[model samples]
Structure formats: structure tokens, C-alpha cells
Target chain A: MEPYPYTVNPFVHQDRFWYPFVSPFDPCPPIRAKRYVVPPNQFLGFQPPNLLQFPPAQALMKGTLWPALFSPYKKTGKVEIKDP
Target chain B: MWVYEKKLQYPVRVSQCNPTLAKYLIEQYGGADGELAAALRYLNQRYTLPDKVTGLLTDIGTEEFAHLEMIATMVYKLTKDATPEQLKEAGLGDHYADHDRALFYHNAAGNPFTATYIQAKGDPIADLYEDIAAEEKARATYQWLIDISDDPDINDGLKFLREREVVHSQRFREAVELIKEYNEQKNFF
Candidate 1:
């Protein structure tokens, strides 16, 4: 059966302002949040509690080897294997 | 032969605006090594660049226009619907804090624009390296802005712009590689 509920991770905050893994930011106080600049009428969907809580469908693995199977260079290109 | 586009990607409308952010963005608009300078630098540099570098310079220069648009949008949104009381509360009620009625001609903040940022050294290597540095700096500033903002709208726009900087940096790196190739070929003769 399909999963009942979906969840999204909060850690995945992607934006111009948020530099992942390397930003020296000290969060402003909650007062700043109250007065935060709310954009006029932009709406995004709600975040789920736990992203990837359920496993991906079994059929997803079927095409995972597409690059190896249909690669243009798989047969024509030379593969040089050298001992290190 | 550039003409004005009479629209904004995202409306610059904000109920409560912070002047501080406006000022920083203005620095980006006209500040040394900022977008305006970057655009002008690359476009002008194209004239003297080798044929190999011509296309790369033109592409990078054109992309600067998009950066300019993004900064202008941020400034506009920060200034739109802003009230004097709100500006004062944000500690931005200075002689230069004229929101609600300004055109797209000032710095990221509300300061009078300056042309000090764009430098064309005439040396291709120097200018190309400078452009690479400028891309990294702009990316850093975008990171700083994202860190302070929780607004998803701004975040969405900001993320795209940041990724663009990364792409531009790669292009500049490629340009450098091409230049090195030309120099090596010349010396080999």
C-alpha cells in the first residue's frame, strides 16, 4: 500500500541567502521574526514531518542502471585500466 | 542596442522593509566589483579579448544584467509600501532613506550611485581574474542574505541567483583555461 503521510526535511533549506555547509550566520531574535518581511502573496506547500520516512517504490530500481546500459561510449570507447 | 524591459520577475512589495538590507544590496549594484561594474567590465572587455575569449566574455557580461535585475528587485521590494515610521523603527530614517517613490537608479541601499566599482584594467588576465573573484564575492553575499532571511519567496530567488554565480565562476575558469592554451601555443612557435 502507498504511504499514508509524506514528510519533508527542514534541513533542506535551499535559497540564495542560505549557504549550505558554510555560512557564518547568527540568527536574529524572535522579535525580528515577528516583524519579518512577509512577501505580498507568495505561497509554498507545508513541510512534512519526516522526509524519506517511507522507502521508495520497488519499480524505481528498474531504470537505475540506464547510464551503463545505454551509454553511447560503452562499446565504442576505449576503457584504459592501469595498475596504481 | 540594449533596451529596457518593462516588468519585474517578482514584485518588489513589502509591508515592513528594512533599510539595512537595502543599503547592502545597493553596494552590490554600484559598489566596486558589484553587478553594474561587472556587467560593464565584461561587455567592454569583449572588444579587446581574443576571438577565443569573445563568446565567453559576451555570455558572462550578459548574465550580469540578470544579477543587476535581481538586486534591483530586492531593493524595490524592500522599499515598496515602506512607511516612515517603519524606516525609523528599523534605524534607517536618514537623509538618504527615501522609499516609496524612488526609481531604479540607486545602490542596493538608498544611497546615491557611484561608478567606482567597475574597473577595466585593459589587461585580459587581470580583468578575468577580477571577474572570477567578483563572482565568488557575490556568491558569498548571497549566502549571507539567505542566512538572515526566512522568507521563502526571497529564498527561492536568492537560491537561483547563487547557483548562477557558481555557473559564471565555472565559465570564467574555462576562459582562463582557454587563455592559457592560447599563450602556450604562441610560446611553442
Candidate 2:
């Protein structure tokens, strides 16, 4: 199967927002579009809790003052590349 | 993996000290929908995502830390020189009673920041959708803050932060699409 080319423009048929439909009975129909029903959430029987909730108290420690302290660093086995 | 930039993403020079506004603006600093939550959510989610998307999450999440700093700076500047009487007059006595002039992470209502503000679901699509929603909520909160603020310097910072939320939402939408495409490819193979 050929890979589907993705485009930034949402109007393209291949875009995620667009749904594809095929009509067998009628070759051509005015405004040929089918209503798509979204699948119910199987994981959670009821609707999920609201994403927005009240702010909670501070938990995480403040980030370190130095850049190297906040993030991880791994030494490379190879020598460093230089433009000069 | 991360570098500390001395300057803020946007300049914040609050000329006036309004403890009342500080009380409200603290929400963005440590609120449920604030930058701290956003940064944690994305950084935690990055570990489970595909490589490219992980990079996206890491970069955006790091940027959120900067935003968090910017908010903290605003809160500190606003309450710097406020006296107990001035604070009481501006309806910030309760906050001052608790934190004095120091900036502690908490919402406008004085609720402390908690881990519950964010989630790190193993699924990318679900997580991306959640992120989009989070950005929208932050944007709405910034809009509210901007509406109540009269200081040009502070308003300028809030506007920049609000616009960043919109941009983040768009990027998350694209991330959703990318993840979907990856799943489709995996199934095809």
C-alpha cells in the first residue's frame, strides 16, 4: 500500500478532519456525505471527568538555577565536532 | 537537555505595584491550568511518546518553565513594595498573612499547586487532546487576567502568554494528527 501524503491544510481529503464515504446504490447524489457516528468510550463507561479542575497546592521543587542542573546530560563516547 | 536563558521570553516591566492584581495573577503562576501544570504535563507525557513527538513535547514543555518564571516574576514585582495596610486595602491581606511578600506557588484563591493539575496518560492521542484543552483553558484564564489588568507592562506579558497558548493548541492538534498517522502505518505493516 502506498503511504498517504499528509498536508498541513486541513481541507485536504487525506487530512484527519475529513471522513471518506463510498456510495454503492447511487452513483451520484447531491451533497454526497454520510453522517459519521463517533464510537463510545469503551475504557470508561461514563463520560470522563472534566479536564479543567481547581488549582492544587505546589508540589514540584523549583527548577535549579543552572541550566545543566535542570536537565539530564549524557557524555558522548565520540569526540566533539568543530566547524573550524 | 535544557539551557537557562537569563532573560524572559518576553520583557515584563510592571511599573505599578498592585497587590490585588498579584493575588489574581498568581493563579497563572501555579493554578491548575497554569504554566507549571502545562510544563509538567508535557514533560511527563514525553517519555511515552514517539521520538519526534517527544522532542516536540520536551521543547514546548521547557518553554512552559520559562512562562512559569515569567508569571512568578510578575507576581513578585506586583507585591514587592506593598505594605500591610496597602495589601489590606487591595484585598491581599489574607495572602500576605500566609506568604508575606514572597512568591509562593498558589492560585488566586490561595490554593497551593498540586500534581493533580496534570496527567500523563500512556496514550498519545488522548494526552494530546488533553493538552489542547489545557491550552484553551490557560488562554481563557489569560484573557480574564488581561481584562482585569490596567497596567500596560503586565497586560503586554499576559497578551504574549495568551497568544502562546493558542500556538501551543495548534501544535498539539498537529501532534494528534501525527500520532494517528503513525498508528495507521503500524497497522498497515
Candidate 3:
């Protein structure tokens, strides 16, 4: 007997994963191009302040990840998982 | 042009914050060799990069952003419950002493953020080599973080970040080789 016409396609499956409210496909919001333009007048050689010199203990952990805080698999990569 | 929908590759959950851990992870945010600096460096350099190095810089620069998010999440979580006692337990009392209960936004060691970490030099060969070094440094830092972390989940994330750094370093090295080959054929010297 033929299958019901309304039956879901077994070959096609929807990802059961949850997605974020924000979509990644959205184009990066446009901002004034000058926002990123670096000024040429500034002395270029000025060393970016090196903060690594202080002992690691001195560093503050203001915004790091917590062990049980989030699920690493909420989002998956498009790339296939091949044995490396 | 073919367009593939883009999305966050990982889900970030805002759990209870631990101020102490936040203070330490801040190192990755604005530290001298932190992910923030790395992202800014590669993104800025991409503009001046030759075609051969463009993809390399973009890929690496984007990855730095993920690292930045990871670090930021860590800090936020650690500080959610910023109690003096908890802070002490997390080994963040020293940071709290100076900052006085305020979680300052700076690099790992409370250093102010600056842009001097990156250099374009207008030379692809030189920049590509620098890129490789940058990746190696980041990889080393992630490895160090993993070594210090006692949490299994945190360690897993750190391990992944460390591996990514290695892959990026390899890519930059390849980009260097490509530039050399191009120059050799063009100059024929």
C-alpha cells in the first residue's frame, strides 16, 4: 500500500537543536566606516600597553567561562566532524 | 555569490557570576597578548594585507573574537557572586583589595587597553611571520589556562581553544610560504 500523502519525509530531518534569538546570517550591522579608521596623526610606534608582565595571579578574571555555566554544544559547526 | 547562513558556533549561558574568576579571566580580555588584542590586531592588519594573506588574517581575526567571548563569559560567571569570602576562596582577594569591590575592565593584570600590540609594517612577509608568533603565544596561554583550571568543562573549552591556536599558527605559516612563492615567481631574482 502507498504511504499517506501527508506523512513526513523520513529522509529529511529537522535539527532538534535550539537556536539563539539572533541569527548569524544577519549582515554585520553597518556603522560609520570612520569608526574603524585609525588616525594617521597618532604616533604609530606607541607600544600597546603590555599587561602580561604582571604575575598571572595579579590578573582579574572578570568575564571568563564557568565550568557548568553553559553547554558547549548549543551550537554546532557546519564543518563535518572528521577524524583528525 | 553563494551565501551560507552564519550563526554562533557555541551557546553561551549566563550562570551565577564569580567575581574572583572574572578578575583572572580579564587577562584574556585586554591583556597584552589577550584575545581582544589578537582580534584587533588581525582584523586591522587584514585591510592592508595582500590577497594571499587576506583569508588567513580574516579567519584568525574572527577566531580571536570567539576567544574574547569565552574569556568574557568566564569573567562574568565568576563575578556573579562577588562576595569577599568567595573572592578569597577563588584567589582573587588581591585584585579586589585595589579595585575595592569594583570589577575593573582591563587586561588580565588590570592593565588599561591599548592598540600598540599590533603592527602592519606594510610588508606581508613580515606580518605573516608575526601572525605565526601571535598564534603560538595565544596557544601557549590557553594551554596554561587549561593547566590551572580544575573544572573539567573549563578544561575542555581551554583544550579546544588551544588546539584552534595551533591550527591558526599552521595556517599563518602556510600563508608565509605562499607569499614567498609568489614573490619568487614575480621577482625572479
Error of 2 at A25 (Å): 57
Better of 2 and 3 by lDDT: 2
Question: Which TM-score value belongs to model 2?
Answer: 0.67
**Candidate with the larger TM-score of 1 and 2:** 2
Candidate with top TM-score is 2
Q: What share of the true interface contacts does each candidate keep?
A: 0.00, 0.00, 0.00
Alpha carbon lDDT of each predicted model:
0.55, 0.69, 0.57
What is candidate 1's CAPRI-style docking category based on DockQ?
A: incorrect
| iRMS of candidate 3, Å | 13.8
Tens digit of lDDT per residue, candidate 3, span B83-177? 77887677777766877555454766666787777677878878877877777677556655654555555555565565566556656766766
User: Between candidates 1 and 3, which one is better according to lDDT?
Assistant: 3
Model 2: per-residue Cα lDDT over B35-100, one tens digit each: 999999999999998776888898889989989999989988988898899998987787778878
Q: What's the true lDDT of residue B55 in model 1?
A: 86
When 1 and 2 are scored with lDDT, the better candidate is: 2
Which predicted model would earn the best lDDT? 2
* Candidate 2 regions with alpha-carbon error over 4 angstroms: A1-84, B183-189
Q: Could you tell me which 10 consecutive residues in candidate 3 chain B have the lowest summed lDDT?
A: B1-10
